[model samples]
Target: MVLRAWPLEGIGEIRPGDDLAAIIVDHLTEPLEAGDVVVVTSKVVSKAAGLATAGDRDSLIDAETDRVVARRGQTRIVRTHSGLTLAAAGIDASNLEAGSVIPLPRDPDGAARDLRGRLEDLAGVRLGVIVSDTAGRAWRIGQTDIAIGASGVAPYLSFAGVEDAYGNLLAVTSPAIADEIAGTAELVAGKLDGQPVVVVRGLPAAWLDSDEGAAALIRDDDGDLFGLGARDAVLAAVSRGELPRGFPVADEGDDLLALARAGTDLSLADVTVAADGSLEVRALSEDGAPEAHVEAGALAERLRILARALRREIVIAVVSD
Candidate 1:
């Protein structure tokens, strides 16, 4: 129930192809126990793995980003190819040599597993390894270190189906223990500190046996309600851009109905849904204003956008006067 964590001091600078496992073993102020969890910053992992790249930071971010979740002014919160949603795709530019940036490890979970194996061999004890990274949260200020990768650790402690003392059944009470350990370690291995590693001891033995890794902590689209930002959703819907997997599919004719009920835009035209499920759009200009075709074309584009958002195939039959 009680955990003790401390940073490993006297660990010197890490560079490309450094033997991180050997460095950790050499600097152990105390011996690691079986239930101890080793938390490491991804910065060092990237460095040791030779992941440092000299390129435009923006280009690096773009290479790591799978899709953009939100954009406000100059900051973009993107979902990385590793399924992590964070600003700048978790690239580190600060606190490193200039003219180079480090993207997150190509495979963080794999990195954690490799580190865990190496540590166990070196330290002669069973252990859990967590690759940590600092990330900004949604609707929260500042940042906190979270476990982006883990090995030989239970990612979550699920209390679902467990009854409380008050006789209440817990339906959804799962804590991400890997992230907790990472955040706890971050408290001691601070940003200003040269420490990049921390040892957390006294965790429950049961929590240390799983090899599920940190990927279990990532929620799929079915469980993620806020996959896209509000403005991003609006822009995607209006521009016929592809929606993230989280958006729900609309019922039949929903797209057409929404377009027909649109105000102002429909004032210059008549939009009707026919029996064949095609949109029948007629330009209504009494004096045959040349703008009618323009309005009709704009409406057709809008119709396509709506259909795309609703996940439906729309056929528009336009009759211009």
Candidate 2:
């Protein structure tokens, strides 16, 4: 696939009502092709969308965020107005007027669709458009540009039923093609540079006619197996301070086995099931110390992690002596 990205130089400060697509189109040396995908950073989109406002960065971040995911003193991972979980609600205080923070577009998907439609009408070519933004991964360092909005492109390529080179059936082989394209575009749209647009060509023919946008990238919450954990659920319940009418019993043995695997010195074989479905876990120290009572609630935390890792529900209870 041929991918090309260049800065739209000489274009000074993008104001609240700037026509970004026009600004980009007028600066391009070559015409956009039929199957080309145009990736634009959401920062510019947000600026044009009038989402930028003058305020303290933290205040703006707090206003835009719905919940905080992870916190480390001053750093925080928050779910933003766009339903995206990212750091600081994707707010940026740099590159704009002092005291002004650039927030993500109110509705990135709508912005992408509008831009794509307008570009197609103006350029007289069928093309895809993706609104890109940098986001951090769960277990990874550094950030990569991902598709927050998309038009005329399939967000993901599902290969679930396809066969590999070995002719083995692929069970879960979906690729987030939109995010991949966004990341590819970021290679040219450097963080420090003024480059805001990238053109990606030569994608597979099947993706050329797709109308699905980044909405396809959102995984169904119900379908997500590792959505919550025992600790998280219990903490949520504890915060409410009321037992749920019908909550699933988290499996404690599975958690114990996982913890043992994590060098906790316990195992499935070391656990026995009681009449009431509680689990009896036994552990012996290297020096042969007396067996200790491991709290079922405490053990539930370990099982919750295992359940999240396995992407399955587990039922567990601690055997009370």
Candidate 3:
């Protein structure tokens, strides 16, 4: 199907406590039509929501982070409360007056719903809405915009169980349409330009007028392959004092020591294994929170043979404090 993204121009600088719904409604070159998608940059939403803070950017990142996903010298990729894995936890310094950084929306799905309701009231037609932010990707060189919030739109178009032209059944195929719309709109909504709103047309009929929010796009740890940072995984594993399962021990050609330090999500923690395959596993607290303790015996059997207990103590010791 054909697609088009038209930038909404002439929007002035958005400010704290501004009426974003009214501002967007007033600045539209034309009224929004049914089935149209309203894509907005989170910068303006943050501005209108008064989300800018005088707090230090790093401090803000720490506050916004729910978990540390990955980190380098000065760059940290964290999962925010919004379930977005982003550098600096989706805290952005761009497009604001000096000395302020803006965190992502506290409730992006709610924000999208509010915007959608207001726009429909003003334009007298139903429409979809998406709030977007820029983020770097895993194993990708550059950054692109992704949908952080959505309303009245289907976030994904699943091809699961559908057959392709070659007639192969599709078991696992779903495109994140909300993110696609957000990225597509960014093509014309220049980051340096004042444009923050854009209207996209020609979306598939299935994705129109849906009330699904962007949170649906998040995959839980059960499905997320890169759930832990290499450093964090290593720290957790070492703290337990035994090699965790899935430690890449079977990859004979790989460097086991470096792999251990890089990080992993050890199933067990607070346990140490001896050379003779003996074990000293930590006891669980009163509530039995350390569910991993049960796996200690299984993990010991794997590590004791490989390290021979003597050579294992002196290793790269990577990961974080």
| Candidate number with greatest lDDT | 1
Stretches of candidate 1 above 4 Å error?
244-321
Q: Which clashing pairs does model 2 show? A: 250-316, 251-314, 251-315, 251-316, 252-316, 255-303
Q: Model 3, 124-208: lDDT tens per residue?
A: 9888999999988788899999999999889998999999999999998998989989999999888788799999987877788
All candidates in order of TM-score, best leading? 1, 3, 2
Output the number of the TM-score-best candidate: 1
lDDT of 2 by residue, 1-321 (tens): 565555455566778888888987887778888988999889889888888887677777767776554444356666565667677778887788877888888888899999999999889999999999999886678889999999888899889889999999999989899999999899876788777788887887788667677877766446645333334443333233332222122333234454433423343224455576555554433434444334333344555554565455555554434
Better of 1 and 3 by TM-score: 1
> Model 1 clash pairs?
none
In terms of lDDT, the poorest run of 10 residues in model 3 is 312-321
Instruction: List candidate 3 segments past 4 Å from native.
Output: 241-321
Please, what is the TM-score per model?
0.79, 0.71, 0.76
The per-model lDDT (C-alpha) reads: 0.82, 0.70, 0.73
Tell me the deviation in Å of residue 47 in model 1: 0.4
Judged by whole-model lDDT over C-alpha atoms, candidate 1 comes out at 0.82
